[model samples]
Target: MADKRPQRGATLNRESNRFNLPERTADGDWLDDQAGIDGAPPRLRTSVTVERARTIISRNTSPDIGFDRSINPYRGCEHGCIYCFARPTHAFHDLSPGLDFESKLFAKPDAPALLRAELAKRGYSAQPIAFGTNTDPYQPIEAEWRITRGCIEVLSDTDHPLTITTKSDRVLHDIDLLAAMAAKGLAAVALSITSLDPRIAMTLEPRAPTPERRLAAVRKLVAAGIPTHVSIAPVIPAITDHEIEHLVERAAEAGARSVSFIPVRLPWEVAPLFRAWLDAHFPDRAGKVMAIIGAIRDGRDNDPGFFTRMRGSGPWADLLRTRFQIACRKHGLNRERIVLRSDLFRPPEGPQGELFG
Candidate 1:
């Protein structure tokens, strides 16, 4: 093994160095009198890339996905979850969805303005603007960027219906805005918690807020009269699956009004990235885990169909569904389905002549 440490500011092509990128040097690599390499230090380097969003609303024709339109305030998430399905999206920009997806993030600094303009359109039809469906709108970078906050503020100002899904406790920073919108019945939130195990969370979501802190966010949001839900998404088969019941139960106790789960989805590039993570973290169970995941995914690492992709299929899938339902029923979660009201939408007052007398 040569001293194949990653160089600072150097980006290895994902196509070229798929999984064989080295990190350490072997004794043979060093000359008889030369010293070994220490390698580059692990540090986060973030670049402020701005995107001028062409349109504010993204509509999904797929029936399985709930909402009709969604707005992603940012492209690429900084949470750094190894199993993120949104990673491949970076490829569209000629960027590797691997490290670049997490490190080289892009923000729609004009999203708030664009959203207001879109809402003010004369023919615009109102529906809940789903935020954070693709990438977390409230990732750690949000503290500084504030694009998500600004979008929420615009939605609040216009009395537009909105819903958010996020894994960051930093959402607490926007409680004032969210609570104000909730007062008008125009807002709802879903906290995506994958596991409660600190160790697993540390390795799985290295940069995301801790599970306990996220639960605290749930409690705080519910207390503020915001309809809050817990989304235990992408339940990794042999890893975080066992913590499902416990997570839901605790979330219920923490004041989450609804609960939902999505089985792990490994699509395209995500499959190999996930396998590498599994091999590195849980070497012994990596093979067993992949086997079980395949069983749930209908004898494949992934099923790209519209309906069965999110929930998966087969015995393993059925077992997860049964377990989730049983746990939800036992905890009385998602019982009422506190749906957000769309009738309260009001067209923007300042633009599109809506306020003309």
Candidate 2:
């Protein structure tokens, strides 16, 4: 079979799992252009599968991460961001970490009920439960599934503290609930804005909301009295790194109370996919970008070490840190961290007769 190019912003034409399976190559006559072979254009459609999870809460012991417990209402994201570090997780389902990770998705409809059950458990303890940690809770699918919204309803009912991180303006749809939770110090949100340049953003994160829309969301959230933060995440070196200061300024101007950033992370299958993206959209500087990234990661494509992973090592990393600090200080970002109150947690009413009995 000839190599089939993916749709714009999509990656990987075929499923390839590097783990628990050996690599396979297809061999046959190749054509320079396979476009008109069948007189039909290749179409990539998003498909969602329902996942019935027994438990909704996931626990992580990694010291590098902030929250210990998180709830992912969905698996896989439709945003099609080439640099998403969570891409490799698709391989566990015998799917490609490339295209399949974005095109194929999973939604957990029972998340709300499961979360309530867990919270009702006798020994359950409440801490900030994070959403959109592994996959975006507000991905396009959420508009239809509403699983994330349902989970939030459960959290809100119990006054359980939680944090959300997303790149979609769909979050605004739940503003009422979020506002109520915020009033009780039970909720906070962070919008991740990678680039303000539309051209770069279009190719980098194809289906996500535009930069302007995200900034608007920050304004809206802040205006509603809900603590809002902006995340200049996955700051690609030689690509989006230059926009750091400007992004911070714009977000801060838009009413974000705090700001944070993370350098691009290429873990597992994400490295190859991101390389392909660079070749497709930024061929001229692709090599230089990777070289700088390697330097930052200590001569590797990625650094998985807990502390070193989030903020890389070496001079490039130091420079980014210095630049970020200067910009934050100049723009008055990160004045304080939003701390949700876990003391307000109260388990929701149990089964109808059980509570009365």
Candidate 3:
């Protein structure tokens, strides 16, 4: 496979949908009738399908994460990170979690309205709603669809708390909304930065914003008074583990309040996809990389036990934690967790009632 195959990250389109859907195969008959024939398949294109979700907010009781409630404005992230643990979810839609997970996408245009309705429930309580918990809220299509901006507008109008995690610099587009919320202690943001190396970043997360741009976004978000932090998520063992200290230093330079890292987790379909990507891009040390990951994950590809899943176990995990802690101490990061205020929340006027002005 060509190293520079446009901007897509997945190496192959594995048809692993649960229903056992037939795999997609190239058809040269149509190509032959249309143009000068080359057997090479046409470049893949992204397609967005509108998902009119009955509800917008999803609640979870997992012990590993911070927030209990969250929202994913879109499904099937286009950033195309080869190791995204969310990849298995696309299998429910009868699509390949590999290439199809990136090329095909979904948008919830009704998110703002649904959010308003839910918030207006009579006994509803307030808590920080996390965006990009599953898929990115500010993927490229966001520039046109503006679903995330619309949801932020709703949150802003209602004085509700929200947190955003994204790898794209597009979050800066809604700086006005976020900054206003920050002024009231109702907002925070974290940009996921995995590797500082351009080459690794290229194949690892083909379409995400460059590390320089993300750090620049951190500077701008900080300047705007948003409690912006840096998340060095999914620290792929051999591929990106070497850049932990460098990333923390850069995050500090950008004025980030905290810097955190998560050792890579390959839960289901993501494991195969990530392995294929490793074999293709980093063949020299791919075995060593998996060995380290296995060591970190307690001799398994993944450990799904609540707390252990988030903070991997074993000697390698301890080393990563120690290095990250040292880096944070050296840079004075993670001094305090930015706490958003839920007391300020006011439910939006909905069909149920218009109590809030």
Candidate 4:
């Protein structure tokens, strides 16, 4: 891998639609071609473009997922997680699913207005609106865009139920709004912590905040009377599976109400990208890791079969579930699932107020 793209998670940024992208590359033509006369390539920088969206809330009916609707204020996560399932989405725009998915971002500034309009529709019943299901709502760009903040404000004003999942401590920026809604039984938050080791974390999720900081955020959210959960997501078999018990212990110590784990799932272009990453970072154990994953996935690179997809099938899968259960029981986690209330939701009054009602 000639062009490792320092501080970025991808080893190769191949074209997703080409249909013949290689699994790995020794020479990164894209990076090398950009070299100056002195032969040093320029540092890659993130660029955000504004997207005018007619609608903000997206609906999904997948039985395997927990939420029915979700809102993503931004697209193309800056966290640059090498194993992100959402990476394939970049291909729709004719962009590379690798570096482009993380560096080239889109921000939806009209989300607040769109959300308010949608919530004001006549006879609209409320269910918890999910955030970060596809992309991180509180990624670094949120610090400047504040689009996620705006959407939350609208939800808070209407007393709507909502849930957020993120890896950044940046969610703390809106604790005031979340805590107020939570007091009314309307909000909950989940933070993803894949690995405790900073070195491993950096390579997996290059731009996310450190694991310790995320734990600190859980403590703060819990202290504020907000329902907080810790997620050990995409537990890389050989790489991060070792930290399950340790992460559970830390989450419990941080006052998290519950903890959950999801084994790695590579779908669409993510599989090849992830494979390239393994070759670059864990050459010695890459084959072993993939072999075990195939075992859990039923002899394939991935399994997209309803419930089986979320919780893989096979002895390895059974082992993971048992270990996770033991760890949670020992740490007093996952006693009950967190549920936000919809009874309190009120239709947005709109700028003109409730003229007809």
Candidate 2 per-residue C-alpha lDDT over 100-160 given as tens digits, one digit per residue, 9 for 90 to 100: 7787789899999999899999988899999989889999999899998999998998899
Alpha carbon lDDT at 39, candidate 3:
55
C-alpha local distance difference test of each model: 0.80, 0.86, 0.87, 0.90
lDDT (Cα, tens digit) per residue for candidate 1, span 1-357: 111122211122253134444322222112333454355333546676988878878888888988999999888887888788898787677666666677778988888888887888898877788999899998878999898889888888778888999999888899999999888788999999999999888777877888999999999999999999999997998899999899989999999998988888888767776776776678899999999998988889999998899888888889999999999999988778766667777777774455574
Instruction: Name the runs in model 2 displaced over 4 angstroms.
Output: 1-8, 14-17, 22-41, 352-357
Cα RMSD for candidates in order: 5.2, 3.2, 2.6, 2.6
* Candidate 1's TM-score: 0.89
The residue-level lDDT of candidate 2 at 211 comes to 98
Could you give candidate 4's per-residue lDDT for residues 1-357 as a string of tens digits? 334677788877677765554432322434466444255344567899999999998999999899999999999999999999999888877677888889889999999999999999998889999999999999999999999999999999999999999999999999999999999999999999999999999999999999999999999999999999999998889899888899999999999999988889999889988998998899999999999999999999899999998889999999988899999999889998899999998788765676765
Q: Which ranking of candidates, highest lDDT first? A: 4, 3, 2, 1
Estimated TM-score for each candidate: 0.89, 0.93, 0.94, 0.94
Candidate 3 lDDT tens digits, 50-144: 99999999999987789999999898988999889888888889787877788889999999999988988899999999999898898899999
- Between which residue pairs do clashes occur in model 4? none
Task: Identify the superior model by TM-score, candidate 1 or candidate 4.
Answer: 4
